[model samples]
Target: MRDIPVVLSGYKLTVVEPPAPNTRDDGNGGQVVVTDRQGVTQFVVALFAKLRVGPGERAPKGEEIKVTLLTDPGLGFEEDSRVELVDPRINAYQIDSPDGRSISGISFKAMGLKPVRAPREEK
Candidate 1:
């Protein structure tokens, strides 16, 4: 199975859920970080974001969608922080299921996130 390309955004991007440290196992006794071909490790952050349905799709506003972000070191986002994802895409991986079945799992990845700039307070 493959991950369907998903572009999730919103006018009011609130966090309904939060992200946790996502880890993986290696063949060795020790665990490993999820990195790219360049060996750059990416931190995983998962959360449910309240967003409106993007163009080309018919959906209601304020639709909540689960978004996963894989970022480089020193990148972290907070709950209810308004932000935008750059070039976000989905990654689908085939995993072994408990019922002896192969299944496709989905996660989201992006170049990074930029905080939506708030209006400058008139001092």
Candidate 2:
């Protein structure tokens, strides 16, 4: 993880798709604990999306930042909901292909992404 975690301030998740099994397709995916109750099929869902960034403290010009977010049980995110990622972790990963080639980039994962509460006015 990076020393200074990346934060997407004033972000709006336009599309939050359903979670899928971390099949290690990337060759560097993390572990996901899967537990069951009454065959309900519960597992930690890995969510990813391309979000529209709002102009805020971090982002002044406002640009789009695609985020690969992971959350437990998944989340029902409505379109254009103002949200923020809490304690996001970014790690660099390198993958070696079978043809003597490699690819490297940073992978992002947030502890949680929730709706941003309205700022309260000072008395």
Which one is best on TM-score? 1
Output the lDDT of residue 23, model 2: 36
Q: Give lDDT: candidate 2, residue 121.
A: 88
lDDT of 1 by residue, 6-119 (tens): 566445554454444445788888787666667666655444465455669764545455554565424445777666666677777788879999987666676656667665
lDDT of each: 0.60, 0.51
TM-score of each: 0.57, 0.49
Candidate 2 wrong stretches, greater than 4 Å: 1-4, 10-12, 18-75, 117-123
Evaluated at residue 85, the lDDT of candidate 1 is 66
lDDT of 2 by residue, 35-110 (tens): 3344333322233334454556343343444444444525654445555666766778899999999999876656
Least lDDT summed over 10 consecutive residues: which range in candidate 2?
Answer: 39-48
- The residue pairs that clash in candidate 2, if any, are none
Can you tell me which runs of candidate 1 are displaced by over 4 Å? Answer: 1-5, 15-22, 26-30, 53-76, 118-123
* Error at 113, model 1, angstroms: 1.1
Error of 1 at 105 (Å): 3.6
